[model samples]
Every structure is written in C-alpha cells, then in structure tokens.
Target: MQDCFQRTDWEVFDHQDLENHTSVVLDYIRFCTDNVTRDRCIRIYPNRKPWMTEEVQSLLTARNTGFRSGDKVLYSAAKANLKRGIREAKVAYRRKIEDPHQE
Candidate 1:
C-alpha cells in the first residue's frame, strides 16, 4: 500500500550507490523483519478444517473441559458426542460429494 511505502525512510543515491543501496536495503529489511515489525503487520486467522462446524467445535470444547476437570462421566459423554459429530460430518461430506443437491 502507499502508506507502507510512505513510511519508509528513502535513502539518497549518489554516483556509485547502486550496489551500496541494495546491501543497505537488504540489511534494513532484515533488521525490520527480525526485531522491529515482526508480527505487528501480520493477521492471524483461526485454523478451521472444512468438516469442522460450530457444533463439532463446541463438542470438542466440551470434551476438553471435561478432561481438564477430571470428570470421567462428562469426559466419556463428551468424547462420544465428539465421535458422533465427526461421523455425522463425514457422512454429510460424502452425501454432499455424491448428491450436490442435498444442502
């Protein structure tokens, strides 16, 4: 973007400046990337699988909570629910692939 370019400190070039300019630019970029603007300019998105719906995610979260709480009954139930959700997702994916008009 124009803002990105405008923020850069442009260096003046002299008669024998081409090679020096390349090295200086490379070093500056390395410095900025390593220590200055590392992840500040990055946008992180949640990793979502194609078959993972909200229902599946919620079930998985419940399972994790149950495990963390050390409740065998809740953990078992949530694990079963997660398995069922995955099975349903696989069936839905296959049905979609087979019949495209199922949605």
Candidate 2:
C-alpha cells in the first residue's frame, strides 16, 4: 500500500525535455500497476464479524464457484443458503444482545 502512494522527486524533470517527460509518465504508470498487483496478492483480512462463521465463508465460496461455473441452480441455492445463514446470525446476535443472561 505504501508503494501505491510513494512520493517521487519531480525536481529531476526541471531540466528535462518531452522525451524525458514521456519516460517519466510511463514509469509512473508501471509503478502504479505493479503496486495494484502487489496489493491484490497481499490479502488483508478485515476484523471478523461474530456472525461470519466458517460455515458462512464456506457457503460464500461455494456460491462464488457456482457463479463462476455458470450453474444458475447451484449459484441460486448457494446464495439462498448464505442469505439464510446471515439472517439467522443476525437474529441470534440480536437475541443475545437483548437477553444477556440467556446463554
């Protein structure tokens, strides 16, 4: 991420010509592209939600695979399962919050 926003010294271009400007621009473009690729390769895991269990993640993966394989029925089923999981998780979370001593 730091590479994406790294600052470059522009003072070197003070005495440069159009060719130098073109080279600089191209280099900058390549730098940005490399940074983007690097960033994608480095997965930054977000703070996990209490409701996002392993089952939910598994279902999401299945859904993605189904969609990629162009299986509409499989994708629909996976999506429905994921939604149901989320809905149940939300309800359970709310219940836990409402009755702190229920556990």
Candidate 3:
C-alpha cells in the first residue's frame, strides 16, 4: 500500500481551486483504499439481550423448526422447553448480576 501511494502521480490532483483539489485527492485515496484492502467477515453479536446464551439460541431455533413442521405435539413440547429455558437463564443472569461472589 505504501509503495502504491509512493508511485502515485499526486501532482495530477494539484488543481488551482482548493475545493476541487481536496475533493479529488480524497476520492483518489478512497479508491485506492477500496481496491487494495481485503474484504473481511466479521461476526457481530447483537447486544439486545446479554442473557441469551448459545444453548438458549439453539432451543429457540428448534422451537421455530418444530412450529414450522406442522406437528402440534412437537411444537407444543418445544414451546414449553423454550419457555422454561428462558426463565432459568433470566434467573441465573439476575443472580450473577446481583451477587457476583455467590457463583
């Protein structure tokens, strides 16, 4: 990247008008950065609920799948399990927050 910038003809953007020259230089820099940089995959976890654990997430997914499968028995069971899991997780989280030393 440094070598690419060093070899650039920066004098081409030296317009007499200050605004045009600044805009051109900024656009060139953005173009070079976009082309030279590699794309990255970043996993951003949502911050809506801190008590939402991986097990709870999997249970939620299972509940949804069961509901979509058109089976009343499976859906009902999954729903009950999800409700119990959520309640347990919330209680655990609250305890941890209120009494950090209790562990």
Candidate 4:
C-alpha cells in the first residue's frame, strides 16, 4: 500500500480544480486500498428482528418451502409452527434481557 502511494503520480491531478482534485485523490486512495485489501462477505441485516434465532430462521425457511409446494395443509402447519417459534424466541429473549443472571 505504501509503495502504491509512493508510485502514484499525484501531479496528474494538479491541473484540476480544488473540488475535482480532492475527488480524484480520494478515488485513487480507494482504488489502491481496494487492490491491496482482501475482499470479505459481511452479512448486515439492518432491519432484522433482535429476537431472531437459528431455530426461528429454520422454521421460517420451512414455512416458505411449504408455501411454494402448493400444499395448503403443509403450509398452514409450517406457518403455525413458525409463529409459535417466533413467539417463544421473543419471550425467551425478553426474559433473558430482563433477568441477565438467571442463566
């Protein structure tokens, strides 16, 4: 990274105005950083429910699969189970938050 910065011809932006020069410099820095850094897959769910757990996620997937299978009975059962699981998870999370020393 340091070598990249040293080798870059910053004089190329000297002819540009202040705003354009700043933008170009920032873009160059970002390009160099991106080339030198390892890419990573970071999952960020900003709107995800705080009480969501792996069990609840699995139940949700099952419900979606049942719905897609065109089986009304199966979908209904899966939906019910998902709802129950979500409720239980929420209650458990609440209890845990309210009584941190319990478990």
Best by lDDT: 4
Q: List the residue pairs that clash in candidate 4.
A: none
Candidate 2 vs 4: which has more TM-score: 4
TM-scores for candidates 1 onward, in order: 0.52, 0.49, 0.53, 0.55
> Whole-model lDDT for model 1 versus the true structure?
0.77
Candidate 4 has its poorest 10 consecutive residues by lDDT at 35-44
- RMSD per candidate (Å) reads 12.0, 15.3, 12.0, 11.7
Backbone clash total for model 1 is 0
Pairs of colliding residues, candidate 2: none
Local accuracy of candidate 1 as per-residue lDDT tens digits, 30-97: 75566534243534358866677788989999999999999999999999999999999888878876
* Displacement of the residue 57 alpha carbon in candidate 1, Å: 0.6
Which candidate model has the greater TM-score, 3 or 4? 4
Clashes of 2: 0
TM-score head-to-head 1 vs 3, winner: 3
Point to the candidate with the largest TM-score: 4
In candidate 1, position 64 carries an lDDT of 99
**Which order, best to worst by TM-score?**
4, 3, 1, 2
Task: Give the alpha-carbon lDDT of every model.
Answer: 0.77, 0.77, 0.87, 0.90
